[model samples]
Every structure is written in structure tokens, then in C-alpha cells.
Target: MRRASSLIAYAIACCLGWPAQAQDYPAHPIRIIVPTQAGGVSDILSRTFANKVQNATGATVVVENRTGANGVLAADYVAKSTPDGYTVYLGFQGTQSVLPHVEPKLPYDPTRDFAPVVLLATGPAVLVVHPSMPARSVKELVELAKAKPGAYSYASAGFGTTHHLAAEMFKLAAGVDLTGVTYRGAAPANQDVIAGHVPIEFDNLGLAVNNIRSGAVRPLAITAKDRSPLLPDVPTMAEAGYPSVIAQSWFAFFVPAKTPRPAIDWLNRQANEVFSDPAMRDQFLRQGLVLPLGSPEFLGQHVAEETQRWGEVIRKAKITLPN
Candidate 1:
């Protein structure tokens, strides 16, 4: 009878302790995993957010770069981790939405394997061309490409990358046959475009801004519905008559699917607090990331919608990666 009473007491204690465990989240160091290399936009964003979280809560937060298989490796690591919220994923649109449609046999299901925390930000791509190219505007570039089908080749980060998909969208929308020259990543692709080896390319606004400002590449159009304040002069793809070619890269935070709701709530509250600061908001704006801060539900809904959108694009473009 005494042993039974003790067992009942222990069960009650465990039930009561659940809330405490959730409240004491980050009792240890939290690690934010970036799927790309250090110094890229993902790396910088993760580090900045980590620093903010650390400063705000006195938590020992750290950012780690687990680069491989175009973010699949890092994502898989986070998906399989213990659902304690210590291991966080800094996921972006490409890996979370686009990859599912492209990779035939993904190790982890993006929509199923993770729980959404928050939608961080979104940045659009810019259509750029070599300075010496006669095509100045989006129309002129389309005219040139249409005039000589398959004659012009654009540089892309890789086969299934955002820029590559943008180029494919452009091809479908403009009825042009511009060849795609694939590079390992955006830096080398942008380098080739700047060197005039490739005449045209679509690149991220943040990474393409400095080169555009320096006149290394001429800006033609932005793949957004509205113009960015940083490049007010640049017209939108819709304005340029290609309303169908809008593509924006987004970033968000996610934890493993079974992570406790309290931990997710705490992380969401922290991110919303840190990023909603006006100074921080303006800082991201200047860097070309438009914050879309909201509840975890918002992130989940947005990811679902984006997954559908990108899946359609991938199907139309027939994009696939090797298993």
C-alpha cells in the first residue's frame, strides 16, 4: 500500500513538472544550425538572431554551419534531434518549400518533420546583365533573348536554385530560350556575370545590391510585385510585363515536430520581440530582408502555401535533383 502511494505521488510530480521543464527551456546551450556556409546571408542572419536571443535572455545560444546537400543535411540533423528545442533550424524557402518538389527521395519531409516557430523575412531577386550588354530594361533583354533564341546564356547558382528557377520562369513567361550556365553557388555565378562571361543572371537583391551599385552588373527588374526602397528606380517584373515571374526567398525558424508547445511559444515570443524592434526592422530593410513577423500558425500556413506554389513551378519547369 505504501509503495502504491509512492508510485501515485511520483506520477503526479512528473505531471506537475512538465510545465517547469518547459519553463526551464535552454537550461543548456541552444544551437542554431545554418544549412549553408558561414558568411552567407543565412549564416549572418542566424548569427545575428542568435546574438539577439543571447542578449535578450542571457541564454548561451550558438550558431553552427552544417553545409551540405544544399541544406538537406542540416535540416535532417535538426529533424532527427531530440524535441527539446535546444537544436533549432534556420530554414529558408529553398530548402523548406522548393526542395520537396525537386528531390525525389528526401530523407526528411519538411512539412511533417518540423514545427514552425516564425517566418523571419523574405527577399526578392533582381534581374541583372553585364554592363556592355545593349539590353538596358527588362523588355530590351526579353527582346534580345527572343530575337536570338538559345543564343544568350544566363548564369545560375545551380539547377534547382532560386535564381535558376527565376530564369526558367522568365523563359516560360517571355517565350525565350536562354541557356543556363550552372555554377556551384551564387558567388561564382555572380562573378561570371560580372566578368561578362555570362551576359545575364537573376540574383538575390541583398547579394546583388553591391554589384549593382558598383555598376559591375546593370539592374533590369525586380521579381516582386512592388519596388524595393533600396532600388526605387528598378521596376517590378509585373511592371516589366512579366507578372508571372515573381519569386522571393524567405527565411524562418523551425524545431523538430514533437517539441513542446511551451518551448515553441517561448522561441516565437523571443523572435517576435527581437525582430519587431524598429531599429532591427530598419536594419533588415536596408539589407533587403522584409520582416513578416507573426505567430507560429502564420509560419505554418505560409509554408504550406509556398510549398504549393513552388511545387507548381517545379512541375512546370520539370526540375529534379539526383537521388
Candidate 2:
């Protein structure tokens, strides 16, 4: 009888301690994992957010880069990590939305293996062409491509990247035929375009800003709903007569599934606080990013919708990865 009474007391104590433990979460340093090589947009964004988190919480936040298999390595690492809120992921559209449709046998299920924490920011891509191409605007480019199908080629970061998909979308929307050239990364792809080897390409504005300003590459249209302040002269894709080609890359925060709800809520509150600051919003804007605020559930819904949208596009374009 005494042993039974002691067992009941212990169970009640555990139930009470959970909330207290969650309230005192982050008693130690936290790590944010970036699923790409250092110096890329993902790495830069992760580091910047980590700094803000550290400033707000006074906790040591470390940003770690684990690049391989197009962000699969770092994502899988975080997915299988302990659900203690100490380890988090800075997931992007490619890993969370595009990979599942392209890689038939992805090791980790993006939807099932991770829980959404917050949506960070989104950035649009710019349709840039080498100055030697002679087509100065989006309409002229489409007309030129229609006149000489397959004569012009476009470059992208890789076969199944957002850059590649955006170009494919443009081809379908404009009813033009242009060959696609794949590169190991965006830097090389952009370099080849700047060198005039590749006539055209779609790249993130942040990556192509300097080149655009330097007159190395000409910006025709931005794949966004509205024109960006950085390039006030560039028109939106919709205004360029290709409303269906709109695409924007997004970043968000995630933790391993089954993480305590209180911990997730705490993390979400911290993120909202950091991004709500005027300075942080301006910093992101200066980097060509637009911050969109939302709760965790909102992020999950957004991911689901994006995955469905991209899946349809991939199917129509017949995009797939080799085994």
C-alpha cells in the first residue's frame, strides 16, 4: 500500500515538473543548423537570425553548416535529433517544398519529420540575361526565344533547384523553347552568364544585385507580385505578361517533431519578438528579403500549399531525379 502511494506521488510530481522545465527552457546554448554551404543565402540568413536570437535571449546561439545532397544532410540531421528545443533547423523552400516532388526516395519526409516553428522571410528571383544577348526586356526576350527555339540556353544552380523550376515555369507560361544548362552552384552559373557563355538565367535578386548594378547582367523582370525597392525599374513577372511564372524562395524555422508544445511556443514567441523589431525588418529588407509574420500553424499550412503547387508544376514539366 505504501509503495503504491509513493508511485502515485512520483507521477504527480513528474506532471507538475514538465511545465516548470518548459518555462525554464534554453538553460543552455542553442544550435541552428543550416542545410547548405557557408556563404550561401541560407547560411547568411541563419547566422543573422541566430545573432538576433542571441541578443534577445542572452543565450549562446551557434549556426552550423552541413551541406550535402542539396540540403538533405542537415535536414535529416535535425529531423532525427532529440526534441529538446536546443537544436533547430533553418529550412528553406527547396528542402521543405521542392525536394519531395523531385527525389522519389528522399530519406526523410519533410512534412512528417519536422514541426514548423515560424516563417522567416521570402525573396524573389530576377530574370537576368547577358548584355550580349540583345534582348533588353521580358517581352523582347520571349519574342526572341519564340523566334529561335532552342537557340538560346538558360543556366541554373542545379537540375532540381528553384532556379531551374522557375525557368521551366517561364518556358511553359510564355510558350517558348529554351534549353537549360545546369551548374554545380549559383555562383558558377551566374559567372558563366556574366561571361556571356550562357545567354540567360533566373537567379535570386540578392545574388544578382551587384552584377545587375555593375551592368554585367541585365535585369528584365522579377518573379514577384510587386517590384522590389532594390531594383525599382524592374517589372514584376505579371506585368511582364507572365503571371503564372511567379516564384519566391522562403525561409522558416523548424524543430524535430514531438518537441514539447511549450518549448515550441516559447521558440515561436522569441522569433516573433525578434522579427517584429523595426531594425531587424529593415535589415532583412536591405538584403532583398521580405519578412512575413505568422504563427506555427500558418507556416504548416503554407508549406502544404507550396508543396502541392510545386508538385503540380514538377509533374507538368516532367521533372525527376535519377536513381
Candidate 3:
């Protein structure tokens, strides 16, 4: 009886300690899933995090781009993955906000299907214009658009993308109608704007920063509440007298659903640590990423807010996409 009781105690201890043992967390190479193709902002940020995490923890971090369906494919993949913290997702505003509004049959719920890790960045869009637009300020641009409603056209990366919705909001707030031309990705949209084929676009800061600096495009306003440090003289839409017009993109990390809180917390702490490092902060800023971050709770709140906010925009704009 004594021997049997001792054996039972040993078994119980192992069972209880199973998760703790696995708390070495990423025992093998981990995957950082970027829902878009390589070279996009989300992909770039995910790679940065992957490299930093690999250096900090000695765990091999691989960035896997699973692009399609405006991120539904990759998001669904991550949603159904094991809750063992081995698979991490890099999510952006499109997946969290626009996709849900545009497509009602999403396979996974953004808030419920994943464990929110930490916000990666809140990169604002810049109001980029062709070189010959003759609008150097937000007021001037509004005047120009007002003078010729629907004459000035803008190109966006896609239908229902944050860039498109932001442009829609800007049109409503500025009381001007700019024809929207959709493209497959930022590269083509930005290309048309730079070549003066389209007169205006509100492009993601990271995507347009180099071109804006190189005179490929001109920036009039940044779509944040405050002007971007990179564009010091540019006014925010709200600051430029358009309070209801704000378009910003937020990127976040997530683990599969039901992941242990400890694992999620640890990843969040690691991300916060990375964000607080001045070197990382400066490097990200140079990459056109702004740190607007906090705990997983903050990401949860952000998801809720943006989901509702973009929903309203889509409804009012009566926006629909083409196949």
C-alpha cells in the first residue's frame, strides 16, 4: 500500500507540472505568421519582431507569409492552431476591422479566437499627393477638392482596406467627393499616385515614406490626431479642422486561442521590453512605425473600438467591393 501511494503521488506531480515543464515555452522553432505577403508593413514589422525575439531568447523565429483574402486565410490558420504558443500571428487593421465589415462570414472572431499578445505599432497614413496637385496644406487640398468635386481621384490598395476607408472618411469630413480607384496592393496604388495618374491618396506611412521623401510624392496631412514626427509640418486631420476624419493602422500579435495566460503575459512583457528599448523605438520610427501600445487588454479594447468605428464608416459610405 505504501509503495502504491508513493507511485500515485509521483504521477499526480507529473500531471500537475506538465504545463510548467512546457513553460520553457518555445522549445522548438516558432513561427511568426504574417497575414500578408513579404515587403508589406505588417511583414516588415513581423520580421523585425522575429529577429529581435530570436536574438533575445535564442529561439529560432521564422516569419511565414500566408497572404490572400485580405488576411482571412492566414488568420483562420492561426485561429485553428494549437494553443501551445508555438504559432504567433501578426495582425493588422484590415483583418481586425475592414474584413469583418466587408465579409460577414469570417471563419474566426478577432477577439475571441486568439489570445491578444501586444500591439506592435500604430502607423498612421499620410495624405500623399501627386507632385502637381497644387495643394500644399490640408486646407488647400480641401479647397481644391471642394472646387472640383469628384474630379480628383485617389488610388487605394484595395476595396474596404484601411486606406480606402480612411479616404472615404476624409471625403465625408472635408465635404468633398474624390473618386476612389482600387488596386491590388500599395505598390500599384502608390505608383499611380507618384506618376500623377491619381491626384491624391492617403497611404500608409511606411509604404509612402520613402517616396514622399524622395519627391515621388508630396505629403499634405498625416491621418493621426497629432502630426507624425517624420512629417513635422504636416497637420493631423483633426488638427486641420476635420475632427471626424481619422485613419490609422494598428498592428498586433496574437497566440492561438486558449493559450495559457502566463504565456501570453510573457510574450506581452517581451514586446513591451522591446518597445521600451530606445534602439528599437528609434529603429521602428525610422521604419515609419509609431509605438501606441500596452497590455493585451489594450489590444482587446482597440479591436472593439476599430471594429465599430470602421463598421460605421462602411455603412455611411455605402461601400461595397467587386469580386
Q: Each model's TM-score?
A: 0.92, 0.92, 0.89
**Which candidate has the top score in lDDT?**
1
Tell me the spans in candidate 2 whose CA falls farther than 4 Å from its real position.
Answer: 1-15
User: Which model is ahead, 1 or 3, in terms of lDDT?
Assistant: 1
Please identify model 3 stretches exceeding 4 Å from their true place: 1-22
In TM-score terms, candidate 1 sits at 0.92
| lDDT tens readout by residue for model 3, 83-127 | 977788998888877877777788998878888888889888888
**Model 3 weakest lDDT span, ten residues long:** 18-27
* TM-score of candidate 2 to 2 decimals: 0.92
Provide the lowest-lDDT 10-residue window in model 1: 314-323
Shift of residue 64 alpha carbon in model 3, Å: 1.7
For 1-323, candidate 2 gives per-residue lDDT tens digits of 99999999999998899889987887888899998778876787678777987887787889998888888998999999999898999998889999999887788899999999999888889999998988989999988999988999999988767689899989888989999999988889998999999999999888888999999999999999999999999999999888888788899999999888888888788888878889988878877888886899999998998898788888988888844
Report the lDDT of model 3 for residue 196.
90
What is candidate 1's CA lDDT for residue 281? 84
| lDDT (Cα) of model 1 | 0.89
lDDT by residue (1-323, candidate 1, tens digit) is 99999999999998898899987887999899999888877787788888998988899889999989888999999999999889999998878898888777889999889999999989999999999999999889888888898999999988777788888888888989998899988889999999999999999898899999999999999998899998999999999999988888888999999898888998899889888999998998888889898999999999999888778877886777744
